[model samples]
Target: MTQSPASPLPSPEERRRLREAASLTQAQVAARVGVSRETVRAWENGRTTPRGQRREAYAHLLASLAEETAEETAEETAEKSAQQSAQESTEETEAQNATGGRDMTVGQGARERADTAVRTAVPAADPTEVEAPPPEARAERPLSPAQAFDALYAFCAPALVRQTYLLTGRRELARESVERAFELAWQRWPEVACDPDPAGWVRATAYDFALSPWHRFRPRYRHPEPPPSNASDRALLNVLLELTPPQRRALLLYDGVGLDLPETAAETEATTPATANRLLNARAAVAARLPDLSDPTELHYRLVELASTERLRAAKPAVVRDGSERRARFWTRAAIAFTVALIGTTALTLRTAPTQYEPPVPPGETVLGVPPRVAPGPLSEKEQKLRAKLRAQMQHGPERLAPQPE
Candidate 1:
């Protein structure tokens, strides 16, 4: 038996045209097809292709609608051609009567009238037919804070965790980083929501948290082995581990996280030039380690995909206790004031206290002495004669003293 040929897949343009011609919204088609509007948009934008059963259903739907639109278009074209012919004939007769059967000018006047009739008879083209508005333009209103948070979380949390994992190389640490980052975002939704790149802010915050040393002391889940197919990735990861912290962070932020050089520098707390240098050095080092890898983008993407295997199911909502912040601030200020007052009071007391002095003890009243010494009495006649002899020798040369000694 011969195998049946496969049905042709509808092109993106065909899908869009059929939808438009069917007067159906993306939401309507998505509802009928059991997919999200975003999925339908992806198909129309050529970002993704519907596969398996959905593809067949989608093709059949479009083909049926396309056939109906073609039939309708044919009927409309035939009706318009008939009306134009009738109007042209009527105008030619009127022109001939107005020109009094003047052949030369009658033909020209009839032609002008017929053209004007056709222009006036046909309605202006529908704007939707001219060009469909973008998907974002169709939004009824801006998303509420809660809705915005949910959307942003759904879109960004997994990638944030993945980037964090790449930064920290631990699953639980990555989850903590992502949770803490989202917690902060929830606490300050107004600011984060208004930020130009809210997702970037979250990713940067998570990556920074992951790199913090504090996580080392926190409880962590067991690390999973790298996927079996990514053996070379393990080698690349080893090379990355060997790099200095700043170099590794810069490389990961630039390539793995898909941040620009300046943004990466801001997150890493380095200047743009310095960040660029780190990236350059890191790339060179990785290249040296993996000589067989020429282009590292694929490797970077693979690592990111591997890290993103685990998804964050839900974000923990931030909790704020009423008046807690106010109370804390109050206590902080009170403590500071009390400390200052205590220091000031101590200083003032020290300065105002009088110094005690001890009066000098009477010289005659020594603590352990028996009595004062009395002056010596005059020397005897022999002592006086000896003194006079000594004085005579002093007045003479030292030779007189030396003879006395001999």
Candidate 2:
């Protein structure tokens, strides 16, 4: 015998049990079940019953509602753990900073000890939580602008900075560009927050800022005009200019940016090792022209030191504003006058000068007057002896030095 259609509805007790199990309010259930709260109330109060599919959907909605009590309990536990770890890390950093510059061995030892203590004291993620794909899942999660800003600053700030520097050799310029990008992000926080790659947007924005006219007007400190005889500084400048923006970026990203190979690839949207290798090759082509440094670190430090010493005052307001027009006009007139003078000089030289039949130049002779090579100054007896010893050592089959030169 088949039951009547009235018997297809759920009993009041069953509805109550399902709602309690699923942790849903009448409104929540009604919304999910395609009905009003009043309708749900009538069913729950046993004045009416949902029919057929409506009854099944109501049951399904109740079953799917989240159990709020369990979620809150887990969140509290996780929050406590996170707070404790953060406090420990902050303490550790402070202690390490306090020990700066006494004995290297002592400072290093102190840091190691602090780090070990924090590692031991901090609670590890629970086994169940650890086994879950939280890291993978987080990529899918949405973050508010403030939350994303905090996360990116803490984890990706260093990487982003290095990336910017890689793209632009000018440190101050790169920093300013990154600052502008962050400002833009802040202005459009709500829109940026919804983006799949907010960091990418910032990076692209930085790229644009670096190329802006205002950025060009930004003060770029360089060594004061060296004497004409100072060939080294001139050579360095030429080498620096030879590097294209992308090549410089590759070097900066690899060495200066502090990113591992894979991280750099991800940030730059390169495929794999091969792409990084191509970038490296491009950098090598430019670095090949630069003056050879006995120690690259020394060169880096010297450059940074020089940069720090230079006062980078803002450019003159008038010049930055509309002075370009006046300068352009002046240069245009000057150029025309100079060009006319040059033509007259060439005409006079060609027409008035008597040309004689010239003999072929000697093999040893230079067409342009060649400056004589300067003779080396006499070395002291001790210095001469040291040089001789080094030459002899080099001749004797690659003898290793007692100390590797820094």
Candidate 3:
């Protein structure tokens, strides 16, 4: 038996009319939905119907096209109205002038009536507020990348800066990375506008920029050597570094990027929650060795402190010549000099003392033929008193100071 001919699809004539009314070509429609020009022609010619998902998409596209067409017509009508009203107003003013301002009141009244009529028609004709948006019945135009960036910045910059700094560890570097990502988005605006999560793309781009060689080497210094024996924080930092690239990616997605599991999956190109779970588990295995991250509140306070300090540094007000500060510095220098002088004088005094020499006396020098041995004198009263005070003060501990003997 012969197969019956396929049920008729939308006619070429109908499709042509719709496309023409919408001011769209076949190629444009095909480009949007990832089809070829020939396929679009065949569908329009009723040779075949777009199957399954494509048919649904096509129907939606056609509806959108119809709405756009209606909106364009409305816009054209509004433009024509504006032009006509302006011409009439000019003509009326001329006529009033011709009447030598004698009918100025009457002419003004007529013009005011006309102006009111126009004002009432436009929803937001006031000079202060923005012009009223086109009716919602129209298809909304897609935003360009620059426009989207502006809107995103207004909504997200506060949170974004924190998030970025957490990931990149440098405010200036983060800003540069974000700006570069936006520049890339602007260059590929056509593709970017259709992306499901444009912000995610920017985040990824920033991550890549943060890892660039130039950024990695930006710090140039020989740090004082770390104390021997691993600190918990240093150990944890090492563990974090040991993680595989993918594990690091997942952790950052959820923890750093603040993405949920589903978003993490999307960013990592993994399918299923199970896969994402495995990735996260792997990351946790590495991270468990790390010191517990500080509390969020503490971190926030730290950021505030850092930002305020940086701002103060940047502002760098003049260093005032305050009496106390100056005195403290002068005293510090004086104390250092006094210490050096005391040390030098003590050394010189100790070195210059003569060595004691007992000359052996001849037999004639002995008194009453008896040799006299040198006898040691008892300690002086002042020395004995100072020693007693020091001993007492030592017994009493640090609370009391013993004054030196006058």
Candidate 4:
């Protein structure tokens, strides 16, 4: 009988995408599968492949997670579509009503005015005189704060997440950073809305979070899609990965995110000159690696598009239901309680402890005993001659051990 071919294992990229789509961090997935995080990372990086029971477990886990993720995505998409349809319907209704009312009022006034002008001008004017259109009904009113924030969130969140992903090279970390920044913005809407560059504030905050050391200990998730497999793109990504974090961040912010030198510098917390230098070095390094690319701008545009596409796929719409304030309050209360407990414990220990005491010395007596006085005997003749020689040496320079070179 012919042997059946064994089922092929999933590719590393497939595994990574499944893990991320399920929102499971490497550590979390590892724990579920009874493996170390490093092992999971190794599997994802193609350093090693799972086998036997481990392989079975990994496959099963991924299958379940992927299925769940698909279901969730479908549900979310359907809900979003329904909500969007409803919102559009409402907006269309409002627009029609407002337009109808405005047209009725404005059309009558414009017609009357135009007629009056035409009649007056017709008597003395040339036949070629053309009437100007009435000025556009006063420009649409400024957006309210809530409307402005919604607009900003829709425009800025995806790009911010993308820039952060380029900086950190991790999808979940980028998402977390961007989400945290938006949470802060939601909490301080007034301040954020009034800021000169509200998007800048959000981007800077996300960048800071992406660079935070806390991420070192936090579990990591992968991007849903693998990077481009083309030689030039691969070379560029490899060079970028090799660069220092500051250099990578500078390049991404300036080229990928389209931030200016000063803005990039501010986001990276470096001086403008330093940021410019980093960009120059990063570009030179990429060029050296991929000399086939004639135009450097092509690389920048490619990276920007890559990051933007990934972010657009990954970023969810920002909702203002963040519980950050509640978390902050809880931490604050916990700290206060801890401080009070520590203080009370210290006070109680002090109150219950024995007092230190010192014993008094007897009146007119030293605490330590004094040594008995002793009489010295006269020096022997040889000792006296030695002492005399020492005194002579002290009083006058000693004779040279060897004759002076004079």
Candidate 5:
């Protein structure tokens, strides 16, 4: 059976086309459809769709638009016939008109089937629900980048914080890890937003940040935090923290986060066997500490329970975004300042440094012009005479203890 006409809307691209081809603006369509301009914009962007009376009205408006542009866009319509579900109905209507049976204009025909004018809409096929487009398709949507970032942060932050808490057993570390990850995401938003797994991107980033061994050097994260109040909870947290960082992360990703082994390995940057070994070791440690949590499923639930018992709250998206922007600005200014300083230092050195090389003075050499000393025999006679005169003048204050050279 064909679904109700109100259930489906046109593809976001074609919805905008139908309105524009009819020479109508979004505001005009929105006004006619009794919705806000943003609602109409969202509908056209595939961010959201209209519903209830608004759905009927929006569908009716689109039908009227198609009829107005039916002739002008006949070629476009023909090209899209294979892609559309209503081609048979459209051809039959035109045929009836030509045969003089149930003759009616495009608008009249649309009124008869206004609810189902554009059945090519893939996202809003169910009137009661709107399926999200694939990440690839979402990346192409021309919505505000900030809005998309905020939406993603809001959806993933809280859960991520809890998960990180399980990984590290510290509430502050978990919160900081998530915030820092988002900050990094915002800094490189172009890459992150276009990624096939934006959530995975953020998740991997958070995991890396949370599991960093360097965090142990920070004074804040160095001290052990107070464990959960309950004995079992504290014991479980202790066991988790006791595991090696890799083991802890692997266990958390595979069991606690419900990721498969391959995914856990990829995220942890390890081979499948290594990740499996880490999980096994981590599970063994936890089970040894608390035998009741030996089962992987039970361990997952316990990890969840332990994480929830802690008061882990992520900062608001605005706070995160503002901090990210602030950090980026600070680093930019720092880089510029450092560059200027380096240039000034180089200029100072250039100004003070010697322009010409001056050869060093040579060491003194022995002189060749000095007179030679007299021979010992001639010097002995003069020395004896001098010594006798000196002894006479000195009056021999004390007898010479030993004979002089004379």
Candidate 6:
């Protein structure tokens, strides 16, 4: 028996054309196809191909949709030609889809990393933080490492700098934090690229760096930079800085950067409930001081506007790469020096070590045989007379001996 060949499915372009022609949204297509909208978008944009069950379901959906679109197109052909309304209708639907896509806010791919981490750790998702991306996979060629890094930096750096600035009320710190994060990203490009969300990785690094307490100790950042020229912005920043770092981070990630509660939690390394509390407390604090920012939406817009007060430009890709390499080299040299010093110290210790042990001297003590002293007795009479005679006469021993000899 011969095996039956599987039925053919439409091309990616055909798939997209059919959907557009039918005025179907990606979310609608995804729902019918048993997948997420991103997955459907990826497929339509030809970034990936559906597989196994998803592939089968997608193929069927496309085939059915294609047949329907064909019939509709034929019926509408005369009317469309007469009114030249086909293009207009397609354009309107495309515009609608574009608007819908923009609503996803900050690439979910990156937010898959954190409240907008690296997507600033990552770029942020503040609906107001960064502009919504257009359709994914508009290009056929995969981005080179350099290209990808540059593209990500250009798209997310400014927004992240803004987000980081809001997180930490220092302009220099905000810029440095972002640059350092990108430098780290460049160093770990392989891991970052392979990560599910590269932007989030960079963003998380940026956020963590920005929120670090160590930054304040740095001489350069020990003092606060000049606040925004606008008194309102300056006051708002001061109010934001007043919140504890955790609370401040939660607020910035959630309200300022547009990261959802869960993403904020992940980025901030807190539980969902804790994150929610932080948000509430932070929001309340801001509202008490600045009533205009009571609403999260308003707060987000305000944060964006405040960020515009300071223009943050990230280091170029080449500069970041160089900095990363320099750091790597410095660490490498430090490690080598440490190892060498340890070896030398060990060698010196071995060389100077004592070869033999000597016992300590014993304490002195009295001798058992030593005689004891007694009081002197009176001299004998004869001895006394001799002594008195010797004392009275001055006698020379040599003269006396010579006289005796003569």
- The lDDT of each candidate is 0.73, 0.58, 0.59, 0.72, 0.81, 0.78
Instruction: State every prediction's TM-score relative to the real structure.
Output: 0.46, 0.30, 0.32, 0.48, 0.59, 0.59
> Candidate 6's residue-wise lDDT over 1-406, tens digit each?
9955554667888888989877788879989987666567668767667777777888888888888988877756644453344344445555655778644433343334332222232223577666655555245688798899888888778888888888887777888888899888988888988986677788889988888777667788877778788899889999988999899888877776655566677767888999999889989999999998888788888888888878777777778778888998999999999999999999999999888998899997767889666689899999999998887674543334344454
| Model 2 CA deviation exceeding 4 Å by range | 1-176, 190-204, 211-238, 291-406
Between 2 and 5, whose lDDT is larger?
5
Give the local distance difference test score of model 5.
0.81
* Tens-digit per-residue lDDT, 244-293, candidate 4: 88888888776776555655776688888899999888888777877754
Candidate 5, residues 235-350: lDDT per residue as tens digits?
A: 88788778888998888887877765666787788898999998898888888888999888888888888777877789989899999999999999999999999999999999
Alpha carbon lDDT at 239, candidate 5: 81
State the lDDT of candidate 3 residue by residue for 1-406, as single tens digits.
9954433334567666778787677779888756655467667766557766677677677767767878988977886796578569868877887978656777777678767756655555558775665674378898764567566544444444444444444556655555555556555656766775566676677667754656554563123223214354344434544665556556655554444455566566776565577555655564465324444333234334333332111110111113224555787899999999999999999899777877787675556866698788898999899999999989858875689998
Question: What lDDT does model 1 reach?
Answer: 0.73
Which regions of candidate 3 deviate over 4 angstroms? 1-145, 156-158, 217-244, 256-262, 270-278, 281-287, 290-406
Off by over 4 Å in 4: 1-149, 219-233, 309-320, 353-406
List candidate 5 stretches off by more than 4 Å.
1-141, 368-406
Q: Which digits, one per residue and each the tens of the lDDT, describe model 1 over residues 155-226?
A: 887667766666656566777778777776776778998885687778778777777766456554334434
Candidate 6 C-alpha error for residue 15, in Å: 17
lDDT of 2: 0.58
Q: RMSD, each candidate, Å? A: 17.5, 39.7, 25.7, 27.9, 15.3, 21.1
- Model 3, C-alpha of 130: deviation from truth (Å): 25
lDDT head-to-head 4 vs 6, winner: 6
lDDT of 6: 0.78
TM-score of 1: 0.46
TM-score (C-alpha, index-matched) for candidate 5: 0.59
| lDDT (tens digit, per residue) of candidate 2 on 254-339 | 44433345545655566657557755665566457653533445445433433333333322223222333455578789999999
